[model samples]
Target chain A: MRNVAVRNLCCGVLLVAVLALAVWAGWVAWERYRAANRPLFHEIGWPDLVPAGWTPPDVLRGMNVNRYQDGDPEAIDALARMKNAWADAPAVKALDGRLVRIAGYVIPLDRENDEVHEFLLLPYFGACIHVPPPPSNQIIYVRSKAPLEGMMTMDTFWVDGTLQVSTTDSPWGQAGYTLQAYDTQHYEVPAQSNKS
Target chain B: MPGILSLALRSAWNRRTTLAFIVAAMVLATILLLSVTQARRSLHESFSQAVNGTDLIVGARGSNVQLLLYAVFHIGDATQNMSWASAQKLARHPAVAWSIPLSLGDSHRGFPVLATSQAYFEHLQVGHGELLQFSQGRMFNDVYDAVIGSEVAQRLGYAVGQRITLTHGAVAMPGAAHADKPFRVVGVLAPTGTPVDRTVHITLAGMEAIHLDWQAGAPLPGMHISAEAARRFDLTPKTITAQLLGLKRRSDVFAMQRAVADEAAEPLMGVLPGVTLDQLWELAGRGEQVLMGLAWVVAVAGIAGMVATLLASLQARRRELAILRAVGAGPWEILALLGLEGLGVTLAGMLLGVLLTASLLPLMSAWLEVHYGISLAGLSLDVTSVTMLALLLAGGVLGSLIPGVCAWRMSLSEGLAPRV
Candidate 1:
């Protein structure tokens, strides 16, 4: 009778131990699944790049830009003023060195074969060809440690990286921000999100 | 289970010859697939490493692709050379940090000659911003001095003090050699695995001096200008094949490209090397895809052969399996026996294939370097290769299961009776 009782006690302990091990294994697996599915970088938008209550210089506030003919002196002067304003555009200092994700169009700089290593990320398409380029604050120079394959000019991508307040000098003038991108994905419309 | 595994092994050993043939086929297929992928990767890496640091290649207004081929790879002739004045103007631009002018169209013993200033040695970068290092001697100082690349020195058996003459064009025709103005080899550069390794370097003055009396690609008759007398005349280069430019700020490249395009004095263009390389790949990527597809077909054929061999043996093994079922073994044991054999054979084949590839790659790498000037990285099992091997493993096991299922059905129906 004592042997039977001892055997039953051992059976109960083994059953409980097995159940506990299964629960612990399930918990670890669930944690891993959550981590794999979670989005890594915080999603941000173009407006986040600009500081609140800051406005662009109104160099051409009253002038009618379209009325002037090509090579008109007044038009040229206005264009120069606009360029100067864009060149000195201020960046949002608070967001410097923040890891964030934003969608932008690519203008490939350094590349190898079909892989792009460095590029300019603009908030809108045709920024290079448009009459007036985007302000310095709107331009984000992105660099990748490993080359991104099959990236082309004007291709939109959701770039995730650490943003910094930096400046790049060009003919039009200085760009205000740069990104050291670790990941870039094709841009897709978020489901059920309101599109402006 | 242990007994079943041993039975499977012994059964496989009974038909070692057939299994060996299947394994050999798998080995050949694996080598082919891996080599194609490796070659494609190395080709891109070699091209990219050749022009790593230069921001732009400015040449005469023409096809960007043509300019890239001529300027970077030295594969073809430049249609026209841009004027020295335009090159100087570009050099003086605020955004231009430095520029190296290149003058081609001369050869020495079938190797193309590159004429540049002292800046080339100081500024030109290769293989990820690595500066050129001389293995022996130094850069040319005298007007008649020459610098040979590593391959040029090794192949021609030249030393630092040897004298060599330039040919007017790429090919060596009779009397085309510039025998009057032989250049002394002042320097020998280390191997860079680029077009540079196949070239002979000289100053722009040396190039001008050698051709001072020549006109329209031929020597002028009755006009013999000695090397000493040639120095008295102007040695300033009037035209250059191309110039490589580096920018003060990388973001200034697009604006600088536009500025070069809009030059009113001369028709000139600037091409981003990386962008142009992408264009070249797009034109040739279809051929690469076809090669990869053929590799896949070969791999699939290998797996199919393994399946066929295992199925053929199943008919012969039916009696063996019935005997096992008769001797206190269950139907599942019969199934496990065949499945284990198929899996074991495939695993052995894969191991041998990997070993063979590892041994063969170094020899292949040397051959490719000597023949094509491509430098391949060492045997690296990157994610893509690992994934391919994994997929092959899955396919192998899945293919072997077919024979296993057949034996299971045969054992269930036969039941200790000889069906064969």
Candidate 2:
């Protein structure tokens, strides 16, 4: 009778060990599932950054800017005016301090070794050079909590952060929008193309 | 289980000579893999720590990478020097908070000599805004005073009062020495683990004082200005190699770069140090990847050898395993015995490999610091390293199981009557 009782006890311990392992594995799988189904931050698009019913100031309205010759005074004056207007571009105040995820091209500002600690995010590629910089509202100055590695200029990334609609002096004189990013992931185009 | 393990240990000892070779191979493979990773990491860290807190590097129009290498790292020569007038203009620009002008093309005992202002000591930073600190004395107070880096002082056995002469060019040519204007070592910098530790610093006025009578890379035929008399003349610098700028606002960097490009006085280029450094890494990244891949291949070969050695020994152990089966041991016991031997060998190799790597790091770091001015951090078991070790362990155990299974089948078939 004692031998039978010891055998039962051994079997019970083995069963408990196996069940504990299974429970731990199940918990890990469930956490992965939840993470995949629901992202940490709400994904936002470039259009959502601009406030509803707000439009850019048309500096060259009814004037054909291309017709002017190079070094023309009138054209230079118009260009200066347009740049000034863009520099003072308005930002959507409601989105201030909101935790969100947005994707854009990177223009690194500061680096420590191979990692970038600060950068500017633009909605399009080659926005900082060859073409005039976008309006202040369109630029997002990002300060990463942890330095980002293997990131280069113009690399597209989906950055998650708290977006602030504050206007600070920029290369363009004055710009709005800053992000304190907690996470940054390389951006990839979705395979599905329903709208197209 | 203890009995099986003891049997396994004794069996392994019987083939100790053969197993030792396998362990040595594993040791070498582990060292190769970990050293390569460590070297790559430290190289990047040392290069980036050379310069920090500076917003822009402006130089004469040329390759951006070349400009950064020469100005920040003192690694290469500049194609042309920007006029001092242009540097002053940029310094006076509203957006610029401060500027440190750098004049190169001189050396002292193979160490590059940098001629800058007092601001360099105040504003220049290394390794995350770490300011330059003096170990011996203060900044140069006179045109003939100089400051030496830690490595320069230690290697040359120089002190605060030691007097040193500068060479006109990067190499120490026969007649290029400025023997007439020997500088008094006013200060010695603390160790920074960057190129600064291998440099010699002097004031711009001192650099000008030495070259007052020299023109077009050579001293004039008849003019000889004594060090004291040379200072009496206007010691203003005409040109400089490059200038490091700090902007009032971080956002004004792009604008400053554009403004520097548009300067009407001369053709100058401004580059973001971080961006250029990234480009440099991208250029060298392919070579680094090839080296890492080679290390992995060597590790795989070492693990394969371990498997082959165990499998070859299995035939000789057939009779022994058969006897154990005849005596009261089961097939499972025989299998566990072989597996335990394999685990024990691999575990020993890994531990020894780690110890060897840790011991060699300081020696390797010293060599690199003397040759390349790059300092390496001590051995650290970060997540990546731990993960790699875990994967290697798994691979080793999985490889050993193959021989164990084969031995189990052999013992089951040939019990008590082994194939001699």
Candidate 3:
């Protein structure tokens, strides 16, 4: 009788403990799934361009973009990632055709002597040039009514325009969003934020 | 309950050294299996990205794999050059967006010299739609000017405004140098993980001018045409190695490829970069699978070692099991205790394996990227790896049953005292 009681006590306690752990894990996972699927209207940054919970999406974070040779599996996955980085970009349909101001580096697409009418706006420098391009959403194709002057590669600019959820394919890179620029200004690093 | 748990812990602590050895073996096996799987997957992924962006690679009719090797990767030599008339006809097609002619034969210190037009840099895309960028200077404009790739400049220690000469063939030997027409380095392209990094770019006209006075493979005897005087004559290339074409629509790729193959001008072929690349990977993937099978065998051996250690220690543990039976412990309880110890060791080993892989991957990946130019994705565990770990744990528990059943039977036969 005592042996049976002891066995029941030990196995019952362990089973309950394991069940508690499993339930906790399931609840946490559910919360995360909800957060990822929630309709969000917050202002986004470069990283936010990729859909929530996507892995291996950041162009510069993990791998060296230039190293994988042709016919290698890694090369194939990287190409698919580049081609379809913005596959689910339209999921955030609320942001389409909305007016938004974004700050980015200018990669001139069509330009004359000292001005540029159309350019790719990137979150960081060297994108679409030396480094593999970021996802489509991270790049914004901007066509300005008036040309911006003294523009060169890696020049930072703050552009105010209507964000249309569209993909533009250019020789430089594919962009998920196209902005019709009404205002443009140079972006300068603030003195306080420089070191802090 | 507490009594049974205490017994299992003390019993495991007695053979801690053997348990440690078993865990170490499992750790090594896990690392090897993971490295091979990750390397093969990443290689195929990176290669597909390079080929998918381009529509068609039009070259001389030969092996599909061979054309991919030279045209896309700049690896081997082209057997024969297609006539310029064939390339021009394909370029002028209404469906073609842009076409860049590639002429490969000469080399500068082992790096292939590609004599193409300005359109090569302007239209050629890498890693999605990324265009080429000049890291140091602009593209070559005049004859006798050269644009070096990032790897070529770094390896040869040549900078813009530096002068370098090309060899007649692809080898870096000291024979048949184009010494009279040394090219001036005008630009250095940024590091592109593609084959472009190891290429030296120049104009097709420049290639024609350098070989103007040459006949067959050697310079014409008793005839010297100065670089300036050679410019007076026609510098058009009569033949080129291949042409890379971009179509207005991707749907036009198959039609254009059919058109190139059925061309009356010359016997030529057009290969879709994506299709040919998949075929090449199919051949290489078989070898990788065989290697992975070997890795699985190593993992199984590690598990066998774990089971052997448990069984070897069972004889010494028989006396302990007999004493517990004398104290009214059930035969089933003996089996449970031994099985629990096995589960404990394997679960700990698996946790350690996860930590070791997470930390080791980032460190090894950095070295791999710098030296081999292969970048591994994030070290976060994938679904396949998680499934493998679960299998390892399950296999470890099943393996533990051998010694568990032995201890159970020994306790039944020898109730108060062990034979040993």
Candidate 4:
């Protein structure tokens, strides 16, 4: 009788302890999942997307970006975390028609055939066709008419315009950063080289 | 306490097989975890270094992802080439610093051929701002000269002056090779652990000359020009697929992007390499989390093994438990002894595992540097790893109590007249 009672107690304790452990693990996993699902960037209303007259501060930090490359679509999961802070962006926008400034390169500049005069803008610095593209560097589609002269080769350009969110996904469309341009202007200014 | 630990070591030495099994488990777990971490680090290093030290990249006005894939990694071919006029206009910006044109349409044995200038080696930066260096020969200067990366050189067994043909598009199966304009190997770059290691770099004129006779990737029926005779045609590339740009003033990147878009030159898009690299990093975070989860599983497995072993050995330790009780050792003392044994075994295994990791790190570093480009010099225990070890030790001790209870019961049953 004593042996049977002891066996029963062992079974009962093991079952309860294991179940408790499982429940605790499940709770931890649930919290982790919840944390992952939470949005990282708080999007302002449409009007708040653009900060009107932002320029390079007294201390300008030059970030290298490859404009010809595309954004990494594999990171579509964390579009929210790519802030100007994390992604060197001016502002994070999940939609289009918002105004923002972007900078990058002009890969294969086409001046003759023009439905839209636009350039591929990178956030950092590089243009290599045979390498994988970075995700934060987005394609800036510009709507312009007149062809400007003397902007040749792979030169960095600052482009200011409104962000037009792409509705459809293209082979080039990836997650993180994407903005089309409207009312775009080019700036070629003398930069104080600190070798940042 | 030192004497007790020495005694414990002696006991472990006596049961070397059992101890060895535990150590083996620990080593395997460590290797698996470490291997995954190394792979993640190297993969990211390779990826980010793919387009490093670049101010901007410009490509076709298609999907940004498509542009990136074809332009940088050479994974796919660009659907179409952008106009040279547009590239020229964007390059002339006053804020412009350095620029390189990349023409991609041809391939050689499934490897994409990049038509670029000699400035590629001088300006191209990768892996924490390291520039490309030639391991074998000099950079390409002539029209028929080519520069290949380290892996390409090794894989193809290509040497200086060895002739090679460029193919059209990414052809895996039998495809047409550009027999007309065979290129001679000029230089081979040392491994940078970047995508450049897989490419064959050539002059832009060579790319144009190779396709002079071929129309739409087919032979122009009997219109063949030998590499010697191909110099008659103007070899200047009409259009390139992509371009890299640097700024005289870094502030002009956005302006250049806008000028290319607004300056009636071309319909294009510019992107930042750093921003996109962060995106890739985010994509790999989940893999990191998954590996960490597996590491936790191994830890749990080790704990369960300790518990099972302690419980299994209780019968053999029954007499010891009775002897302790006879000599005024209480139930708590029995518990403490068994707990100490468990802790000792786990601690030993963990220490040995850590030592092995440290010793093997240099060899691993050498292999990774030569092959995968990961700097594994900092393989010492981090806070998280230390915490894991501590948790394993504590859990092992606590888990032995299950068997310790059995010993307590045995002592109660035997009392002073316990049998060995």
Candidate 5:
């Protein structure tokens, strides 16, 4: 009985050691897998306030941003399609002159007294900084009634404003939409939750 | 099973000196294989991620890789500068959304000084679509102000508001320093893990201002203009080494490239950075393969050492094997015991290698990033590495066959002479 007990004790210890190693490896693999497929954002809260007639921003990017052909009629046609794509983008007629809230990083075009009133609001940081700005549709020209203080370039902000679907060309890049913002607050992303 | 393992452990401990040497060989071999693979993978990744978002690199007629090296990586000097007129004309093209001109041929303390317009800060990109971000201060707005990269700032211990002077040429030769015109540090960019982190940036006006009185690469006699007064004159740059172009549409890249190549104003060349980078990888891939081959040879030698030690020990362990046979252990059990012992050493060696790599990476990661533009992968083993180690253990077991057979024969022959 004592011999059997010693044998069982050895087996138990070996099994536990193997299980610990296996668990650690599995956890690491699962974390890596989750990182690979993480969603771009969680709700960005756009649809909650979007009017019945309006379309989401990604829909515009999907339409004509990824594909284009150069030369002759195809070039002209592609340009037209791009133009129309922006015009019909966010295709919500109701969003025009409607009050909305959005978040983006600032690309200051003009500043005064360390304050920013006219700037490009970008969906991501680094846009218009050291990299080519994203598609015009991805940028918004924001003009604030009250100057936002301590506005550093590339700082994120949540702006409450009236949304306008229009295009404006700046020295830096082009913006397909405009925002007459009344309130701007610093932006922060909540800690990511492990959904899987 | 426990009895077999206990016997193997006691036997290995009895020859601990030889066994220790075998373990050390396995450890070195494992480290060699893992590091070579890691280095090759990271080198490929960092190189490919060097340039992105820019549609075309336009420069005076030159090799595509050469232009890429000089313009994007600051690795080589440009053969010739395209006329500033041509650069402006390229910028004004209808399909061009933005253009960032690059003017090289200057250095500060061995770090290249990149003279470009504000557009470089506004449009140039690095790995994975990231734009340059200032860790402190802001972009240089005056001709006498400069922005340094993270590596330059850390190495030289410079901070915002510090002053620096650049040399006229790429190297800091005596009397080549533009000491008459010292620039204030207006900004410092965050660590980028690219060549950009080792560069110093200044405006086009800054470049022209420093050379205002210089002719034929020497300062003109009796023409010392103060940095403040130099700003009074027109600092319009007449030439630039290269330009990165961003098009209104991605499809226009090929057309714009052809136009630049066939440009009548000057003999210019244009290349897609991504395509040229792929060509560079093809050239580098062969060297990486040779390194990996050498590492495998080391691993094979290590396995041979393990086999030799076990085979040589068979004569001394003959009475021990006979005692096992007397206790009813079969020939097949003797083989299994020897194979298991080899596998245990291999597994222990692999674990030690992984721990050593993991510990060394954190200490060396920053140094590697600053020097080689390589951010070592984190400690967790990837599937490929884990699979490789498993195969290594399998090979170690196979290598024990000669020793296993010798032990089996000794056991069968000496079963009756166990007392010896």
Candidate 6:
């Protein structure tokens, strides 16, 4: 009887001790974690480089730009649609040289649209207006020398002087993609027949 | 059953001195479990509320999380500044219901100085569309006047008419201070248990005023002016970091976002607050999960300790068992007596846990609101809670039965002889 009693007593002490240690260890670790987790508010300092261009519409200022990952399906679909439209990009061989005109969404035709005259060419249906803006889903730039009126629709046609692809970042499109335009024309959306 | 429970109660009461210590341990463990759950839930809700009713947060160009952090919580500094012109243009959009302009890069003491329009109070809603209320004075009335949060007032002890300088960062260092213009506290907001409580809110004009004599992050080199003199300058903020927009139609949010991205004027982006917050929660939940898991382990250890205490006492309970058997008690009755004791202890300890948790709600609320931008869920018995208690009670009873079964077998083998 005394043997069992002694054994049980030792087991009780061991269990309690181990549990107490676990509690203490957990508490110590939590305390250290709390102390180490001082808010990063005060520590914010100027970065070595200011972002170089119109930030991707998906990105925010002051946010660590390195953390943004654009995986929006709608934006991807829009990009794919534009890529499809640019396949033949309408007979560049037919109108080579002599300042020919073509229309597309004003994707920054050049990388430095903010500083230089460049931006990408997108489709007409995707224009975002003040009343119903494009989902902050894509970085669609319009290289219009003139102010834009109404929706920057996906189907609206614009004239690009020639294909000059400059990779330099635009003044405003910092840490972003800029496409420049040579002279571009904004085209009205053409009516489509309703064929089921 | 009463007789059996009476014997068990007497036995537990006799060892109550030791069992009571274990109960205290359970009380602490329960607090750890419940408090962590409450803290995390509250923080997420409170954070979502600080931005109130805005559908999207638009900024010059950066990460969505960055915009959410500064434009909403004011926890971090904004890296990019948007021209107030750009914000105004976005506001001109037909779909926009309202837009609150915000300028970053200024602080009052350690609290962030949010240069926002009064539209924030008009639009800001918290915890089920509740409007912001004042604990003391009203909102900022004058251009240089400020409205502080409850925590800011309590911590700095500033009141109406008390003047304070603005700092650029989260700290109170004078080097980061905009000492040229001192603003009076005209209003204070009630405690919202969110980042709003820790921030200092001022007019966008106020932000532009202090920054008028500065360029980038410094005073315009070789150009200087007094705060009073600067007030004479036009206060229209030429640029701002971001704008919060509410649309007439929720469906137009995406389209508007795309328009801003495609702006012929500037490269800009707008992000939905709910979507951004979810992304952040998924990313930041890793550390939180680890912490919660550790606390859960403590709760388990507490339950195990209770079981172990009951198990250990069985050996000392051998004489009591022998006396019962000799006095016409069956082996099953002896087991029942011990089982009831374990069950009673669990119920008692849990009762104590409920009391401890109830008493600690205020302290927990204060700690969470000040340290983390979370509001704690109030103390109430919910489905999850009922389920947890059921598991603990069932587990405790079953665990104590282990020793009861052993004693029953031994007593049957030895008849009236003491197993110990």
Candidate achieving the largest lDDT? 2
Write the residue-wise lDDT of candidate 2 on A90-140 in tens digits: 677888888899999987876665688889888888764545556657778
Q: Candidate 5, residue A142: CA error in Å?
A: 31
lDDT of 4 at B294: 93
lDDT of every predicted structure (CA atoms): 0.82, 0.84, 0.75, 0.62, 0.75, 0.64
Q: C-alpha displacement of B281 in model 1, angstroms?
A: 2.9
Candidate 1 residue lDDT tens string, A1-196: 3354457768999999999999999999999997797557888899988888877689888898879998798987887677667666677888888889999888776555447788888887766442455766777889899789878777789998899886555545554678999888998755895776
- Candidate 5 residues lying further than 4 Å off, grouped into runs, are A1-196, B361-368, B372-374, B416-420
lDDT of 5 by residue, A68-156 (tens): 55445554555544444443333234456767778877755333323455666776665422233344455666888787776656678
lDDT assessment of candidate 3: 0.75
Residue pairs clashing, model 2: none
lDDT by residue for model 1 (B24-131), tens:
877777777777787788788788878777888999999898998888778878998999999999999977889999999999888889999998999988886799
- Writing each residue's lDDT as its tens digit, candidate 5 over B22-112 gives 8888888888888877666665556545666677889999788899988877776778889999999999997789999999989888788
Model 3 scores a TM of: 0.62
lDDT of 2 by residue, B1-420 (tens): 455557767877888999999889888887888888888888888887885678899999999999999998887779999999999998988778889999998999888899999989999888877899999999998998999989899999999999899999988999899999999999999999998888899999999998988988999879999988987899899999999999866656665776687577899989888778778989999999999899889888989999999999888888778767766677776676677677777778888888999889888998877666789887777777777777777778888888999988887788778888
- Rank by lDDT (best first): 2, 1, 5, 3, 6, 4
Clashes of each: 0, 0, 22, 95, 4, 78
The two-chain DockQ for each candidate, comma-separated, is 0.18, 0.29, 0.02, 0.03, 0.02, 0.03
lDDT of 3 by residue, B299-331 (tens): 799889989999999887777787777666787
Off by over 4 Å in 2: A1-102, A112-116, A135-137, A146-150, A163-171, A182-186, A190-196
Per-model TM-score on C-alpha atoms: 0.79, 0.86, 0.62, 0.61, 0.68, 0.66
The weakest ten consecutive residues by lDDT in model 4 chain B span B369-378
State the weakest 10-residue window (summed lDDT) of model 6 chain B: B248-257
